[model samples]
Target: MRNGKGQERKASPSFFTGEKWLVLTGLLGFLLAAICGVWVILYGGPVFPKGDVLKAFSFNAALGVFLLSTAAILPFTALGNKSRALFRWSYIVLALYSYAAETVQNFRGVDPRFVKGGMPFDVWVGSIFTFVALLLILFYLFVAVQYFRPKAYRLRPELIVGIRYAMLAVLLSFAAGVWISFNNGRLVGLHGSIIWLHGLGFHALQVVPFIAWLSERTALTHSARKAFIHLAGTAYLVSLVAVGWQTYLGHPVLEWSVLPVLAFVSLLISLAPGIVLLRRQSDQTVPAGKAIL
Candidate 1:
């Protein structure tokens, strides 16, 4: 620990800080929600009508929620206080987007169902489900702020944790698929050729920013960046293949394949940016040591 004059300097962002816990919590929430969402899509059966689905999870609203959630948590975990405004606004955007989605769904002749029992397409029940998703995102946002403090910060541009999360997401998706098949006789919506590849493309897009952030933390060499970029591109291609297969099978949520692809793509993208900015302080690097604080 040395100051400018080479005197003793205490290391900043002490180990006891709560940033680590916040990140862990956020990551856990994200994973849990992702698993549940995938399960609902793959195994849970039709909870809402098609028009309602469009209304509740519109294209723009879905992107906003996904990115904002990522932005709210990932950056806070890494950069600490650097992007306070962005994080705060992400939350605001998340709420507004959810509200708008619900409203749109209602406006589209999608009446909320008042079911006495458990019908999957019950409108009221389905809308409530959206809140569950929103709640997960909101809780993660809170955890991000409370955990990742400003002081002793450094981004781990390598993004090992994120990659691990991605792997977990993949496992969860596969589990969801299997669970559905075992419980019911078949996979409901996301099983066959009825699926759409574009949804998978959107999933890939969702993860790019997160990976880009990871790249900001590491000190990547030019060659490494190029290699990583190629890897990311390849992962995207893999996602496309998976999506195509799902579509060919008429699967309902063919887009589920994108989550893992996003994870790999994110890692690759994050690693590549390090090459050009290796020498900088890497202000974005949140201390891996403190990830559980």
Candidate 2:
């Protein structure tokens, strides 16, 4: 009976084992939903009557959905450390804040420029939907991470520095993009959440490097992880340059295609370290001090 129990324990999942197919399927489902959203923006009928009103709706809708989904899914996949318990609660707070924002917006009016077509605090529904979507994503993300990855994963200081630097780069890039757009008077011209899309995309690009750094410290060991990170970083950098060049050429890729890709890629990259570490060792074998930051 003792031997049978031991055998059963061995058969059961450990940290080293990868997530089941179902969790991955959910991730893919979210990706598909994102694609559907993009399609609506590019080809579907306009939501608002006027041009600018429609533009804001399109932009806000897309961005709100992306952030909500990310905030929901990523906490579970990468950010579920005891240290990050604050963040988990913060998600809840943010959801409530979203609800409040919607309520206030209804009173404030959806469109400042056009009173006729707009309803008071009109974006309320969008906000509520975004918040709920975020909540669901986070719940699933948490479940996947908790079950699939080791709980006590320690992130290296260097990796933390890398994350900070990546964030700094994203901020600086966004500021530069905004400044250039403003000075060029280009900012005044674009419809939809083009600026937000650019900002989010640039930030997402930075996440790749940060993930690489973390992967080196945790999931991967020896020279293998380093090699993979270096290669992946090179690929990411190349892609960024290519995207920038395209945008500069006055033929930017469609936001529908670009934004969701950026968000998903960033989320996936951020999870690499934890996923790798969990994949390489059993839950009991993995040290307990390590936690996601």
TM-score of 1: 0.32
TM, every model: 0.32, 0.37
Tell me how far the alpha carbon of residue 80 in candidate 2 is from the true structure, in angstroms, after superposition: 11
Q: In model 1, which range of ten residues has the least summed lDDT?
A: 151-160
Candidate 2 per-residue C-alpha lDDT over 1-293 given as tens digits, one digit per residue, 9 for 90 to 100: 11212321111112212322323333443454455456456855333342232333333443344344333223223443563455445544454454334323432434322234444344445445454644644553443343234321122322323333333334434443454444533333343223533454445433544454445445333345444454444444444444454345455445556644554464455446445644655433322212223
Give the total clashing residue pairs for model 2: 14
lDDT tens digits by residue: candidate 1, 1-293: 43223445334332214334333433443444444455447645233443333323343344444443444334325443645445445544444444444444443434332223434555454566355444544554454344334321233322333333332333333333333334332334445431134333434334533453444344444234334534554555555555445444555442446544554455455445333434444554533322211
Clashing residue pair totals per candidate (backbone < 3 A): 34, 14
**Whole-structure CA lDDT of model 2:** 0.40
Best by TM-score: 2
